[model samples]
Target: MSNIPPAGMSAAEWQTRQELAACYRLAWHFRFTDLIYTHITARVPGEDGHFLINPYGLSWDEITASSLVKIDVDGNKVADSDYSVNPAGFTIHSAIHRTSHDAAWIMHTHTRAGVAVSSLEAGLLPLNQIALQFHGRIAYHDYEGIALDLGERERIVASLGDKPVLVLRNHGLLTTGATAASMFNTMFYMERACEIQVATLSMGQPLRKVPADVADHVATQYQSSMGEEDDVLLEWAAHLRLLEKIAPDYRD
Candidate 1:
């Protein structure tokens, strides 16, 4: 599609599209994506019940700011675009965004490590600092085949509750935040935690659990360290710079 920003679009909405596009590109760069499978969606600024998601069939790296399709909570396109949205994939995201005011951005992935950890009977063990960040803030939703059925939306939302991270049992991982950067930040760590857990477990050696109290304390410490300035924004800025050096076309 056209790279130029659409006429009459607010500066805020345009920025949101760019940030979401950058998130997709970054996921591709970091190998967080599974071909064109997973989806990342951002709520349209100042627009209630609307979101921006990658067009169906586009590889994450092939996605651009202008290529993102705007759709309502029902997964119906709200804006004109050559590409169509993935209704099945949007079901998970739409369910969360519909129920949670804080879920301004939603990220889902099917990474190998994430899926491996999801299949475990004891999900996301507190094996390290990265995993500890989700000590009491993670939820698990049992897999129910593909997410094409709209009836599964309520169950997914119920399973997620108010947690920022959700480990789709035997499926993959999902993360939500009030900002695209924040969501991306959570996914980055969550994926790393899964990767570490899988690697550690593969050794078949006894694993040491970071004590519950310590995990709680560390989670609180991490939250305290995030002051007025948003860590995600800072991290996203650095990532954009890296993308500029490599794949700047995502901004198109």
Candidate 2:
């Protein structure tokens, strides 16, 4: 809400804007966006504390590089924009931002596959290597309906403690990262993992799962060998290029 920059915003702030905006467009292209419901936020470039988020009510595909609003950790609109932000969106994002120092980029979604998996009593069954990667890292936050109450922040924060990803029970998914790319990549993997797990479970056959030690080894290798650059934005760039060929209006 305040106009004060978290630190001082720099010329690079504009670049962060473009990338974050591109992320939104890419989300729509992936069909990861849920109308105007989900939110993706990025910290302002060269600024220590401020971030940019979409104004509520705008379809994710409608977001443009220049249309994002600046806001502090408190969730007030700091910049001039025609669009408004949802308090619930701010509530979820702000809690993570405040508690997690590594959360430079945060994303949340309610994809059908994600919500379906969340509702299942089993919750993200380890039916494959992907699910196993999150064997101990993923946290679960029971849904409290629309996430408007400030009281929910405590539980949300506690559930997400030290974990990079969270599956909000009967609600959706949340991911935190050191960059927008990493967070997006995490969400994509989590959603896919859930989708496959659900589909596999529906088959009603004996399910094959990875050994916990092997899963941990693979996850450690992924972290050490691949590193952060191997995230969604690399492929996401290709996705945006494809969107340009088809739904060019998303750039508007």
Candidate 2 residue-wise lDDT, 1-252, digit = tens: 112323544556766676677778777877888898878988876666678888788898788766888888777777777888888888888788767778888888888899899898778876787776676778889878988887888788999998889889988989988876677778878888988987887899997777777877877876766545754567657766776786554333
The regions of model 1 sitting more than 4 angstroms off are 1-4, 226-229
Which candidate should be chosen as best, given TM-score against the real structure? Answer: 1
Worst 10 residues of 2 by lDDT: 1-10
Q: lDDT of all the models against the reference? A: 0.89, 0.78
Q: With candidate 2 superimposed using the best TM-score fit, by how many Å does residue 191's alpha carbon deviate from the native? A: 1.2
- lDDT tens per residue, model 1, 1-252: 123566888778888898899999999999999888879999898899998999999999899898999999998899899988777788999998888999999999999999999999999999998888788889999999989989999999999999999999999999998887788889999999999999999999998999888999988977778422466688878988998998888877
Candidate 2 versus the native: TM-score?
A: 0.87
Native-to-model Cα distance after best TM-score fit, residue 108 in candidate 2, in Å = 0.3
The local lDDT score (0 to 100) that residue 156 gets in candidate 1 is 97
